[model samples]
Target: MRPLFVIVALSFAPAAYAQEISAVCKYEYTVHDQGQKSGTTGEFSLKATYMLPVGQPLNVQVRTTKAPCYEFLANGDDMQISGTCSRAAQNMKMVYVYKIDRMSGAFEEHFSINDKTGIVHYGHCLPAKPLL
Candidate 1:
């Protein structure tokens, strides 16, 4: 009886511990591939939310190395993102709706343009560290 009880308790612990950590952040990211003969370069300003094992929903503004790269803002179900695509020589902006899943801890994030509808999909992006 004791062993069975221990197993059940342990199983539920992980779900219980999945608390949320929230913070407002700002970061700069650079994407460049030298091997490619022709590559695109730009930056983005994004407001994001993630599930962290600490407090609330993490919100952030991310920018690119280039000026006017991109910008994103979110308020509940509403999200607005804008930026310039220098390689294509096109200025683009978008506003959309997003559902928030508030949880806790560092989770892997995948980035896409216009809900994964575009010529290219920017894959894995790491969280930026603050400078000293």
Candidate 2:
């Protein structure tokens, strides 16, 4: 039985390695406050990277944010991926939520700072290319 146990463990060894999901997403967004829209619209891009391991919460890093990392939750299926990230600082709080359709690369994002400011973004993401 010891030999059988060893074989079973070896079979699952490959899955124990870390997995990563990385993407470069671009957005065209408008700022809003109190139901009023800003006169200017802008475009921005963010790079999101997540390190996922079995039996552990995802470790995430997003570029173009004040914080290096945020608390994130993911709800994903075969067709779509959705998640939210939130961070807080002295007397201020920020939240960002996004949904991406895996097939078409379409995505929507909402970012809010405190209670009074918000921005809505619409765009697409593609897999990130390696720097080197």
Candidate 3:
């Protein structure tokens, strides 16, 4: 009876710990862009959410009207969260890279289209309330 009870408890322990290791971070960014051809500058607000799962790639969902969710593999871990993803659209390849400091909440995002056009976003992030 004692051996059976011990085995059962040990089996359940890993699942509990895995759940606790998952994290979600929400961020709001001020987008800055200068027109490549027109040389016009503009600014706007953007929101994004990042989900990090244990032993798996992280995912980011930008809160835009028509943006697709992007997946990013673990890049580095020097006291920060960082990832990169790339996709092709309209005959152009796009790359996105982001990093957030764990202590200062400072966030930076870079988006490049075919290595020709690029935009950088700067902002901060905090733990977000879980959605019901």
Candidate 4:
């Protein structure tokens, strides 16, 4: 009986160390435009909330916004952006393509920008990107 008890306890111990749900992540990004030859920068922030369950894919929602510019909503595997500050030649709004992988934390975030377009993009995804 003692040996059987030890085996059961050890098996459950590993499960107890798993990541938890209700994880919140935040990320900030800055974009610089070198083409203008004027050195201008744009900034944005992103927040992600999600749950992590063993043997289940992480579920998450990503929200990003650039003050006086645009806001975006990304849920699960879908990404969408809307809102505009002005009606200029350039499209005030644009959609981004991305994917998420499981990592250590329940939630994860990153800041990045397109080198050629000088488009600053920042956001968080979950259940955090895989470390490997």
On lDDT, the candidate that comes out on top is 2
lDDT of 2: 0.53
Model 3 agreement with the true structure over 52-132: per-residue lDDT tens digits: 333344533333221332343433232455666688878988887777565444566678888865776665543333331
- Which consecutive 10 residues in model 4 have the weakest lDDT in total? 78-87
The parts of candidate 1 lying over 4 Å away from their true place are: 1-60, 75-118
For model 3, give the 10-residue run with minimal summed lDDT. 14-23
RMSD of each: 12.3, 11.8, 12.6, 12.9
Name every residue pair that clashes in candidate 4. none
> What is the per-residue lDDT of model 4 for residues 1-132, given as tens digits with 9 covering 90 to 100?
676555433322222113222212334443444422223234334444433332334343334453332323233422211212222235343324333322322122222233234343343332223221
Q: Quantify how close model 2 is to the true structure by its C-alpha RMSD in Å.
A: 11.8
Ranking by TM-score: 2, 3, 4, 1
Candidate 1 has what TM-score? 0.24
If scored against the real structure, what TM-score would every candidate get? 0.24, 0.54, 0.51, 0.26
lDDT score, candidate 1, position 66: 26
Clashes of each: 15, 0, 0, 0
Full-model lDDT, candidate 4: 0.32
